[model samples]
Structure formats: structure tokens, C-alpha cells
Target: MKIYNTLSGRKEEFAPADGKTVKMYVCGVTPYAPAHVGHAMSYTFFDAVRRYLEFLGYSVVHVQNFTDIDDKIIERAARAEVDPAKLAERYIAEFYDEMDSLNIRRASLYPRATEELPTIVDMIQGLIDKGYAYPANGDVYFRVRKKDGYGSLARRTLEGMLAGARIEPSSHKEHPMDFALWKGAKKGEPEWPSPWGPGRPGWHIECSAMCHHHLGETIDIHGGGQDLIFPHHENEIAQSESYTGAKPFVRFWMHNGLVQLGEEKMSKSLGILVTVKDALQKFSPDALRLFFLSSYYRSPLKFSEESVEAAERGAQRLRSAASIEGQGTGPDLDSDPYRRRFVEAMDDDFNTPQAIAALFDLARQVNRAFDEGRRFDEAQSTLRELAEVLGLTLRGLESGTQADIAPFVDLLVEMRGELRKAKQFELADSIRARLQALGVTVEDTAQGGRWRKG
Candidate 1:
């Protein structure tokens, strides 16, 4: 399989270092608030990538880190008059709900910054011991110039970066480009005992330390949103490479594009956001996954209710076709072509849009089978297998409005079945039509009278 490496600026063949397991690290959230749809989009994409890699026979050990202790979390906690750890835990639980709703696979390890203080402290000390970092007034900063080719990931020279970058005033740092490794804790803020006074790990260092401790000195792939390509990931590279004396801390760098509301990116800091909870309540999981996978991972995706509704309709088409049962009297159905097309598209930089198109094409073929009075069991199973790889759970062709009414629908379906057995064709047909009007579809296949909410 080929993947787009953000570091090399092109698509390259994927080869794990040990030729067996692929170690992947994707940056997680700060847990200051509930996760938004943008977070859903990124995590969903990575989940599919991981699934596809495993589908190709490589064991994937994925690690996603949580920034439980951050300036945002602390500041928000203070505003609400709550302990920062309590606030972080609340939001972290809320994030899990969102991820579970979106069907995101749990990472192999979810190391939190608050839980990795010792490792974070050791990493900072190692940087200082190597002369690549220095301590100043109970704070520590990494010397940016000490790392050669610092801006290679972002593809900008030091002078260019200085012109465009926002230089925050820091009295301890010798240069504006130098970033913090540890910040001295204040009286109210959470702190850990460290060599450089009481302090907490910086945002960038927490990830480096967590990934190194969990995955090893170097990993196969490191992924995050495109917005992190700059100072955040660049700083991670600076510290991780310098601390380990490894030339390339990560072999493959993967980044997904931002999800947009209008012209601006959907971010909590921007104050314009759509929470994942809102989306999950309004749309099905298949619909949300379809909405994001409709576009390439590296391209910015626009958010709209209309778009999600359209995706829902599209997903309904696939589900409806998948629900068809073959009569055993039609022509033979083959799914090999569809499977081949899906793999071909996915192998090229994990092209989900094209892969979904292959699914649609199979759905169309399955529908054609029903029209030709042919059996489509093979096609239906194939559709399920391919969609499973994308982490999309195809809902029952008939999705009911409420879970509490399943028994009631089953009673109605059973009554209709008896009516048909008594040779009451017209009355039974009327019953079927009434059920269909109520969003329940009853199909009397050779197997039995199967019914589901549509």
C-alpha cells in the first residue's frame, strides 16, 4: 500500500520497520471541552487507515495521546471553580462517548500528560544533557537552531518563518523560535516535582515523550491535522530527534485536512463549532462516515446539514440494495470485481472517495440482480465486508425511529404472515402497505416473512 508522507511531500510505499507491526501515533485532544465534528473527522479517517492497514495483513499498534493538563484546561477549570483534573476527566469521558458514537477504534495506548510526568521530566533532562536545550528561571526551552533542517516538515526557511510566525514574548527563551519544553508551575496550577523547579510538560513535549515511551525511540507513522504541521509537529520533531539522536524520529508523517464551517476552520478556539453529539443525534453513524469519506482526507471538507442529509440518502441506497434476498432462480452473482476495485482504489494513498464509489457500483449491481430475479447473497456479504474495512456499520435496510417499538412491529408482521397463510392475499397486502406507510417494510422472501423499519 502507498501512503502520502507529509515529511517527504509525496506518496510512498508503506513498509513497517520490523516488517510485521506498524506503530502509529496520532495526536489527541486537550479535553477542555466536548470534542467537535472536526475531531470526529480526523479520528474517523485514521481509524479507516488503521483498519485498511490491518486488512492488508500488518499488525498495527496505534497510540493516541491526550493532553489532559494544558493551559486551556486549567484556565477553563479556574473559570468554572473546579479542579483541573476533575474537569479533564469529565471532558475525557465525554470524548469517549463521542468516539464510541462515531465508531472510532480505541488506540493501543492513550497516555495522558498528567500520568506521564516522570517520562516527560526525563525527556526534558535528556534534551538539556545533550546541549540541545537549556533551563532558565525554573523554565526549560529547546534551542531551535541546534536542530538542523528544523523547518523541513513545513518547508520554510528560518527567515521566512520569522517573518510569518507570531512571536510570543518569553523572557526566558534566548530566541523567539525556541519553544518551551516545561513551564514553571504557578501557585494554583497543577505541578510535578522536576529538576527545573515544579513544572508541567509543554504541549509538544508531552506527545514526544508519550510516543517514545509507548512505541519506542522511533515509530512507523505519526499523524494529526494539517494545522499541526507547523510549530506543534515541528517542535515535536526538534525535541524527539534531538533527545534520541535519531536522524528521523518518524518515518511516515500523515495529516488530514481541517473541517470547515464557512471560510474559517471549525475549532473551539474560533468559537464556531458543531459538537459531535449534535451530529450523532441528527444523523446515523453510516451517514456521518459517508459525509467525511466523500472527500479525500487531505482536502478540506465543508460542513452542512444538507450535505449530511444527502449522504444519508446515499447510504440508504446501499443499505436497501444490501437487504435484497436472492430467489435462487436468477443468474449467479459475483463480487470479485467489486472487491478488486476497492483494494485498487484504497492502495493508492488510501483513496476513500474512490473506494466508496466502488461500493456504490456494487450496490447498483446488487439492485440489478434483484430486478433480474437473481440471488444476491454473495454481493450482499461482499458489501458488508468492504464497508466493515471502512468502519461503517450498515444499519438495517429499514432503520426504525424508536428502539422501544421493535416488538410492536414484530407483532404486526406476525399477524400479516398468518393472514397470508389463510389465503387472505388482498388483506395481507393491505397490511404490508400499512406497515410500509408506518416505515416498516415486510418482504416475504423464500426464507420467510422478514420485516424491518425503513
Candidate 2:
């Protein structure tokens, strides 16, 4: 298998540092607020990557960290009149619900920043003791010039970096390019008692400490959004390697493309952000997963209401086809050939769009099998397996949202249909009104009425 390594700026063959096991870490959210579509896009892509590796028989140990204590979280908590820890925990649970709804597998280790303060302090002390870091006032900053490969990741010259950094003229710093490793806690903010006075770990230092604590000195793959390519990831590489004496902190650096609203990037400041909760009310969790997986992990995907509606329609067709049960004596289920196409497409750098096309072809095969009145058990099994490998729900459980709506919708539709046929127009209108009030949208189509949650 080969993956595009951002560190090397090329697609290189994937060889694990350890035999038969792939150790990976992807930067996770800060949990200041509910997860947005951008966070979902990045995590879902990494989940697919991890799932594919596991499907290929590689024991994958995936680690993603939660930055529980950050400036944003502190600010949000203060505004809400709550403790920062309580606010972080609330959003963390909400994030888990979103991930579970989309069928994302839980990571092997999810180390939170608050839980790993000792590790963070120890790593910073190691860097400072080794002369790669310096304490300024009460805060600790990484000495950027001390690392020979400081600009290797970002590929900027020292003179250019010094000039380019939007640095304030601070009292304590050897250079303007140096970034904080430990931020000294100010009053009215969340903090912990650390060796560097009362403070919290800087954003970049948290990941380095977490990876070292969980995945070890080096990992096979380190992934995050494309925005982290600059100061965040570059600082991680510098601090991690400087402390551990490891040549390469991570062999592969996979950065997912950013999420955009049409031509503009979706961001909190831009006010074009879509939260997962608001999105789930309109599109099924599976539809969101399908929409994200429809693009290559490294390519930017533009998201819009129209695009999501299209994906929802397409995904519904797959689910409808998978629900078909073959009659006795239909097409030969064992003779279908679309599985090979799906596997081959996924093999070529996890080209999910091509893989999705293959799935559609297989769904057509099911249609053909039903039209011919042949057994389609083989096609059904193949579809389920393919969907599972993609971390999609082929056959939803008979619980949760599906279960609650399935029998109720059928009963309500049947009653409404009976009333309409009986010419009791007033009663039929009343039933429709009640259903609509309950958040069920009933639309009359050519064949009959269709119902979905509003």
C-alpha cells in the first residue's frame, strides 16, 4: 500500500515501523463547541484510512487526542458561566455521539490534554534540559533556530519565518519565530499546577506529548487538516524529535483537504459553519458519511445544501437496493463480478469515488437479479461487506432512529391512505396535519405517498 506523505511531498509505499502493526495518530478537536462539518470531514477520512488498513490485515493502533483545555474552551466556559472542564466534557460527549452515529470506530487511545499534563511537562522539561527550549518569564517557548530541520516541513527560510511570523514585540524571546510550549496561566482562566509555574500546555506541545505517551517515540502516520501544516505540525516534529532523538517523528504525514462553502472556506469566524447537530436533523448520518467519502481524502470537497441533497438521494438508492430480497430462482448470486472492481478501485490510493461507482454498479446488479427473478443473496452479502469496509451502515440496526420511525410511519401512512380512499377528506387532512406536526413530511408522489422526517 502507498500513501501520499506530506513530509516527503510524495506518495510513498507504507511500511510500518513495527512488523504487521500500524501505529497512527490524527489531531482531534479542542471540544470548545459542538463539532462542525470540517471536523467531521477530517475524522471521517482518517477513519476510512484506518478501516482500510485493518481490512488489509494490518493491526492498526490509532490514537487521537482531545485538547480539553484551550483558550477557546476557557473563553467559552467563562461566557457560559461554567467551569471549563464541565464545558469540555459536555461537548466531548456530543462529539462521541456524532462519531458513533456515523459508525466511526473508537480510537485505541483517546488521551485528553487535561489527563496528560504530566507527560506534557516532562516532554517540555526534556526539551529545555537538552537546550532546545527556553523559559521566558513564566512561559516556555521552543527555540526554533535550535532545530536544524525547523523549516523542513513548512519549507521557509529562517529570515523569512522571522519576518513572516505575526509576532508581538515581547519581552522574553531569543527570536520572534519561537512559539510557546507552556503558556503561563493568567487569572480567570483554566490552568494546572505545572513545573513551569501554573500553566497549560501549548497547542502544538499537547500532540507531541500525547503521541509520545501513547504511540511511543515515533509513529507510522501523523494526520490532521491541511491548515495544521504550518506552525502546528512543524512545531510537533521539531519538539518530538528533539526530545526523543528520533530521526523522523512520523514516517508519513497525511493532511486532509479543507472543507469549503462553495468557493469560501467554512470557518467559525466566517459564520458559514454548519454544526453536526443541525446537519443530522436534515440528512441521515450515513448520508453525511457517504458525502464525505465520495471525495479523495486529500482533495478539497465543496459542501452545499444542494450537494448534500444529491448525496442523500444517491445513498438512499443504495439502501433501497440493499433491502431487496431475491425471489426463488433469480440471477446467479455467485456469478457477480462487481466486487473485484470495488476492491481494485479502493486499492489505488483509496479512490472512494471510483469505489462508490463500483457500489452503484453492484446495486444495479441487484436490480438486474430481481428483474430476472433470481436469487440475490450473494449480491446482498457482497454489498454489506463492501459497505462495512467503508465504515458505512449497509443494514441499519432495528433500533434508534430507524426503529422509532419505521413502524410508526407505516401505521400513519396506512391510516392516512385508508381515510383518503374512504372519501373522508376531512379525517385524511387531520391525519396528515398530525403527522406533519410530529415532524414527518408526507409528500404525494406518482405511485403513492412518501414520508421522511422533517
Candidate 3:
């Protein structure tokens, strides 16, 4: 398979270093707050990548890290008058829930920054011992000039980066372009006992250390959002290779484009984000996945309700086609061509848009065959299998048996009854109409309101 490599700035043939298991590491959240759709977009794409790799008969060992001890977590914890660790744990649990709702597969291991302090300290000391880093004023900074290919991943020279970069002026830093490996302890913040006094690992070093501690000195694939390319991932490359004496820290660098809201990217710092919970409340998990995968992984996607609603409709179409059970025994549909098209599209740097189009085309053929009284059970199975490769569970929002949805239907009916009692006839009628649209019919009797699946 050919996958895009940001390191090489082109698509290249993909193979594990060991020629067996694929060692993958995608950056995880900070756990300062609940995750947003931007997070969903990144993780969902990675999830699909993992699924497709498995489908291609490769075992993938994925390790994602949690930056639990971050400035944002500490600051937010102080505001809430709670311990930072407790706060981080709370949100980490919430993150799991949100990802689960989105049908994202769990990573093989999730290493937290707080739990990996020893490895961080050791790596920092190793960098300093090798003269690639220096300690100044109780903080450690990576010597940018010491690394020969400092900005190779970013495709820029040190001079070019320094020219346009926003260098934070510091007395302890030898150069303005130097980034912190460890920060000095400050009042009212968490600190770890490191070689450079009592301080915490910098934002970039935690990930570097985590990857080394968990995955190894080098991994097959390293992925994150494109926003992290400049200083975050670039520094990761410099320090990791410097510490481990490995030439390439990561074989493939995969970065998904940011999700935009209005003119600005949806970011935690900007407070411009739609939480995954809120989006799932309005749209199905399948719809959200489709919306993300409908766009190329390397291209930025604009957030819109209309787009996701349209994806929901598309998801329903696929679900309906897959659910059809053929009665006549004539000719089995030839699904091999569609499968080949899907595999071909995905093989070309994971072209999910074309792959999704193939699925839709196959769905149309499946429906046509069903209408022609031909046995379509095998074709339907193929549809479901291919959809699973993309992590698309061919199930609607209100999937499962009648018992599972009865509670929600009953609640809606009760709400409609209250609306009718309040003389809000319009809203009550709308709710009834919605229920009918979902194949659930409601009846009003002297006893109360009743609901049944049609």
C-alpha cells in the first residue's frame, strides 16, 4: 500500500520496519476538557487507518499518549478548585466515553505524562549529556543548532524558521529558537523531580519520551494534526533522534488537516469548538464518521450541520441497502468489482472520498438486484464487510432491537403529551410526525399516549 509521508513530502510504499507488526502512535488529547468534533475527526481517520491496515492482513500495535499534566489542565483545575490529577482523570474518562460513542477503537496502550516522568527525565538528561541540550536557570532547553537536520521535517532551515517564528524571549535560552525540554517549577503548579531542579516536561518532550518508552526509539507511523507540524512535531524529530542516536525517529509522519469553524480552526485555546457530545446528540455516529471520511485526510474540512445531515441521509441509504433480504434465487450480484475499486482507492494514500463513492455505487447495485428478485445475501455481506473496513457500522442512529429504543420512544411520547397539555399543538404534532418518520407510530387513548414500532 502507498501512504503519504509528511517526512518525505510524498506518498511512498508502506511496510513495517520489522516487516510484520505495524507500530503506530497517534497523539492523544490533553484531558483538560471534553473532546470536540475536531478530536473526533482526527481519531476517526486514524481508526479507519488501523481498520484498513488490519484488513490488509497486517497487525497494528497502536500506542496513544495522554498529556495529563499540562498548563491548561493545571490552570483549569485551579479555577475549579480541584486537584489537577483528579481533574485530568475525570476528563480522561469522559474522553473514553466520547470516543466510544464515535465507535473509535481503543489504543493498545495509553501512557500518561504524569506516569512516565522517569522516562522523560532520563531522555532529557541523555540529551544534555550528549550536548544536544543544556540546563539553564533550573530549566532544560534543546540546543536547536546542535542537531544537523533540525528543521528537515518542517522543510525549512533554522534561519528561515527564526526569521518568521515567534521566538519567546528568555534569559536562560541560548537562542530564541531553542525550545524547552523541561520547565522550572512555578508557584501553584505541578512539578516533578528532574535533573534540572523541580520542573515538569515541556509540551513536546512528553510525547517524545512517551513514544520512546512505549513504542521504541523508532516507530513505523507517527500521526497528529497538521497544526503540530512546526514546533511540536519538528522538535519531536530532533530530540528523539538526538536521544536515541536513530536517524529517522518515525518512518511515516501522517498529519490530518484541521477542522475549521467559520474562518478560524476549531481549537481548545480559542474556545471555538463543538463538543462531540453535542454533535452526537443531533447526528448519528455513522453520520459523523462519514462526514469526516468524505473529505481527504490531508484536506481541511469545514464544519456544518447541513453537511453532516446530508451524511446522515447517505448513511441511511447504505443501511437500508444492507438490510435488504432477497427472496428470489436467481443470480448473485457480482460484488468483486466494487471490492476491487474500494481496495484500489484506499491503497492510493487512503482516498476515502473515492472509496465512499464506490460504496454508494455498490449500494445502488445492491438495491437494484434486490428489486429484481435475485438472491443478494452474499452481496449484502460484502457491503457490510467493506463498510466495516472503513469503520462504518451499517447501523442507523436508533439501531438495535425494539426493546432498546422503547425507552426513548416512550420518553418522546411523554414529552409530546406534556406539550399537548400545555396547548403547544404545533410542537406536539411535530414530535408525532418525527416518530412516524422513524417507523414508530404513536396512538393517543383515554389512558395516555402509546407507541409501537411499525
Best by TM-score: 1
Output the lDDT of residue 435, model 3.
91
lDDT of each: 0.90, 0.84, 0.91
Clashing pairs in 2: 329-374, 330-373, 330-374, 330-375, 331-374
What's every prediction's RMSD, in angstroms?
2.8, 3.9, 6.1
Candidate 1: misplaced stretches above 4 Å? Answer: 397-404, 413-451
Among these predictions, the greatest lDDT belongs to: 3
Distance from true location, Cα of 329 in model 3, Å: 0.6
Clashes of each: 3, 5, 0
Clash-forming residue pairs, model 1: 326-375, 330-374, 398-453
Q: What TM-score does each of the candidates earn?
A: 0.93, 0.88, 0.90
RMSD of 2: 3.9
Location of the lowest summed lDDT over 10 successive residues in candidate 1? 395-404
Higher-TM-score candidate among 2 and 3? 3
Per-residue lDDT tens digits of candidate 2, residues 1-454? 7788888888787868886899999999988877889888888888988988888888999999999999989998999999999999999999999888777889998999999988999999999999999998889999988999787887777788768557686778888888899999998777788777898899999999999999898899999999889989999999999999997999999999999987977776567888888887778777888899898888988989888888888887787678765355844766246778877777776788888888888888787788777888778778878887888785532345454666878787877887877888898888788888977767664446667664
Error of 1 at 265 (Å): 0.6
Candidate 3 lDDT by residue in tens digits, 222-296: 999999898899999999999999978999999999999987899988899999999988888999999999999
Model 1, span 146-258: residue lDDT tens? 89999999998779878975777688888888889999998989999999899888899999999889998899999999999998999899999999988689999999999
The alpha-carbon root-mean-square deviation between model 3 and the true structure, to one decimal in Å, is 6.1
- Give the lowest summed-lDDT range of ten residues in model 3: 394-403
